[model samples]
Target chain A: MKILVVDDEADIQPLFLQHFRKELRHHDFEFDFALSGEEALEYLKGNSLEVVLILSDINMPGMSGIDLLSKIRQDYNYLSPVVMMITAYGDEENYKQAMEKGADDFLTKPLDFNLLKEKLKKVMNNG
Target chain B: MNFDYILLLIVFSYLRRALQSKILLPKIDKYLAIGFWFSIVLLIAGFFLKFTKEINAWIAHAMLFTLIYFCLTQKEFKSVKSFIYSILPFVVVNFIEDCIELINSPFHDEWNNYFDTAIFFSIVWFFAMFFITRKQRKEMEKEQLKAIEFEKEFQQSEILKAKLETQVAERTAEILGQKEKLQKALDKLKTTQVQLIQSEKMASLGELTAGIAHEIQNPLNFVNNFSEVSSELLDEMNEEIVKGDFEEVKNIAIDLKKNLEKINFHGKRADSIVKGMLQHSRIGNNVKEPTNINKLADEYLRLAYHGFRAKDKSFNADLVTDFDENLPKINVLTQEIGRVLLNLFTNAFYATHQKQKKSGETYKPMVSVKTELKGKGIEITVKDNGIGIPEAIKDKIMQPFFTTKPTGEGTGLGLSLSYDIIVKAHGGTITIDSRENDYTVFTIFLPTE
Candidate 1:
């Protein structure tokens, strides 16, 4: 199974890689990285790639995470994929907006990787 | 014949009275009265002296001249001409008698004929005096009538002058009263304007808060989360050590070290956020004072609407203020908060104006401000019926420099700065609710304490 991560912050890459090292080694789960919402859309265009789960950051320079989530839902959510939004601040306003835009789930930074793992395990089981 | 002393005495007595009348009237303290009596006695002694007939006749003429002079002093006789006319009959009779005496060889012979001629002259003198006195009385009557007319005119003028003075005083007082009322109204207007300007300055703080929160909160989260996870990892390491898993312990040690590095990085990020927030807030430095929140909001609402009108002449809006009269006075930096209100009102006006342009004459641009007493504090809302923010960019609205307005019109830092003022400085919250084509409402909550 392949999980896609979209974020503007370069540091998030290393953090996630270290956090999911065990899962990457033991389970047959592959990870892909996209710097922005536009970049993620480009990667999704490939006919061979099967992106099952998408993790996106809400705030960015262009094509914010919320916009990316809406576009994914409108175009490809029926293809057995789940999208979860990440907000910098755990404000209820942003949380509600993400949910209204068809986000499956949302979390705040610095992300609790343990909780995220538990949720992902559920996604992995369903997929 | 007669000794003629009796006639001489009678004539002299009459002369003495006329001369006495020529002397000035005696003052109340008559110091010279004794001297006058003594002179009278000398005149009587001269009558007994047995002097020559010529001497007696000369003395008698002197007395007659003195009598004429006395008659001149009478109040009825004014100028020298009138005096001469008054004594003319007496003087003429005396002159005729003197001529007769000269013809009779001396004044002594004329004395024998004096009684009959004197009686004839006395009749003439009485007639002249009667006419002169009658004329004088007529002149006096005319003078009295003129004095009465002058008194009446003077009284009328005095009454007119008094009336005009009172009227002038009443008019002056009326003008002063009007001036005082006008000054009071002007003072009220100026105070309202000042409060509005203060709120305008604070509006920028909200946008600054949004930027600062996003930048710092994300890193702070990382620090907190990594620290908590590291502690949990230590317990896992303890469990592994009990099993004598040496390799697993080494991996856990490496993971803990990496977590500490991230904690350090995010900790520094949080520190910088605090520094930046302080720096930004300092720019809005103002001393707090007891403030009426309702008055502040209402004033800014009017000022903003007028400000928009000044920029675009065609722009107009129905501005409304619904203030809670029961709200208590709160301690606040009046100018800073006034600035925030000004910014919000200005944005509201701008939104309404833009909508008016799109919707034409049928659309009425409306902007309203409301202040209400809330839990231990106050709440203010600015609402506008105009162009609402699009949903896609709603989350970005509070971020610094994110504006839908064209360049030169909006810096887009207004909402962000207002957010900073309310949340960071005042321990308050700012929220927004909007529909795409309907309305935009910004609600602010402030704590009293």
Candidate 2:
């Protein structure tokens, strides 16, 4: 399975890679990274079929996670990948908006890698 | 002869008493009394000795003339008109008596009846003179009573005037005391105002606390994650070393080293954020220190944005910063200048947020901060693409207690206090340029010296 992780913080890339190093090394999962929602969208446009899941942070500079989610749902409805939103604030409003906009799951920082791996396995099995 | 002397005595005594009481000339009064006594002695001698009638009459006339002289010489009667009116009666009477005696000597039996008539007329004239002197005395007494009343009224008025002056003095002292009390109260109020301003600075810091937490959280998250990864990498390295895979062990070692570096980097990031927060909230002595303007502006810009974001999670803006790299450090009150920058950045974010709410998705909120090295000074510019300040309120924005924010949402002292910090405290100049519904730019210029 291939996953795209989008966050404005550049360090998230390395952290995610290190946490999933076994899966990445075993060829069980492949990872792509984008620094922002805009970059995520650009990545999805070029390589939408290869990515099976999208993990994105909600707070970003140019385009937000919700905006990106809605845009992806509207533009790529036929190739809809599972989209999960990550946020520092786990407030009801953001959760409601993300759910309403078709988010498959929600996560809050600091991310628990064990739980995240379990969720990723579930998604892999479902897909 | 004795009767004639007695009659003259009676007339002289009456005149003396009347003049003595009214004119009040002590010397004249003594003389008049002595003359009266002398006249009495003359009468006694006339009775004792067998004097001729003519001689007796002559002696009586001499005594009468002496008394009249005394009365006429009195100050009250010294005027010719008064003397003629009062003493002329006695003089005419004496003249008539002398003429009658002289006529009787020529025709004794025939003039005897005329002599008696003349004596009766002289007696009437003396009575008239006595009455006139009594009326004059009464008039003088009335004048003296009026003068005494006038003196009494004058003395009472003087007492009243003195009382009024004293009252006025007391009232003046009282007013001065009240003024001094008011001045003291005003000074106390001024000190209270200074304390309130310090609290306001703390309040702004309180507003930034949520943002500061978020800022620190990001780095903290990285620190935790990186350390955990490094520990895992160590475990992997240990396993690889046991498996005798030197290449993989070296790779794990490199990864571990990178993770450690990241942890250090993120730790320092968190430390700087905390240090900035401390500097902002510090109640320093307004001491000027060499400071980098760009770093100050950039730190505050991020802080204000994050602070705004923490409050309204949906709100976001494009933060653009243009800092002069070669700019020299200038002396400034660091905390004060930081506050000024925070205030400006916060206002910019607020303005853009408000415009976003109104204009919806069509409006992109943008706040840009720029610092430049101008000649002899530095300039800082904060620009916002939002609902700009209206022309009518542009001039009032920097005045204390002037605000566009809703009640309880703002204390309205942000810009005013910033103005004080930038302009008065640091000898800087702040100016605003804005167009309603378009944009706003706040520029501050601080001298290097």
Candidate 2 local Cα displacement, residue B225, angstroms: 1.3
Worst 10 residues of 2 chain B by lDDT: B77-86
Candidate 2 chain A weakest lDDT stretch, 10 residues: A59-68
DockQ of each: 0.20, 0.58
DockQ value for model 2: 0.58
Candidate number of the best lDDT: 2
Q: Mind giving the per-residue lDDT tens digits that candidate 2 earns over B160-233?
A: 98999999999999999999999999999999878778777887888798888988999999999889888888
Local accuracy of candidate 1 as per-residue lDDT tens digits, B1-449 = 11122333443343334334236443411322433443354456556665544454544555545545544675522433343454556555654565566577455464756745674665466567657765885797788888888888888888998888898899899989999988998998888655543343443445334544556666776777677767777887898899999898898899889889988988887785566345334544567779889876764554455445445433546667788999898988776677678778878877877887798867877888888998888999889998988899989988877888888567776788778878887899999999977999999998999
On residues A49-84, what C-alpha lDDT tens digit does candidate 1 reach at each position?
Answer: 488889998865446687788888888866847889
Model 1 TM-score on a 0 to 1 scale:
0.47
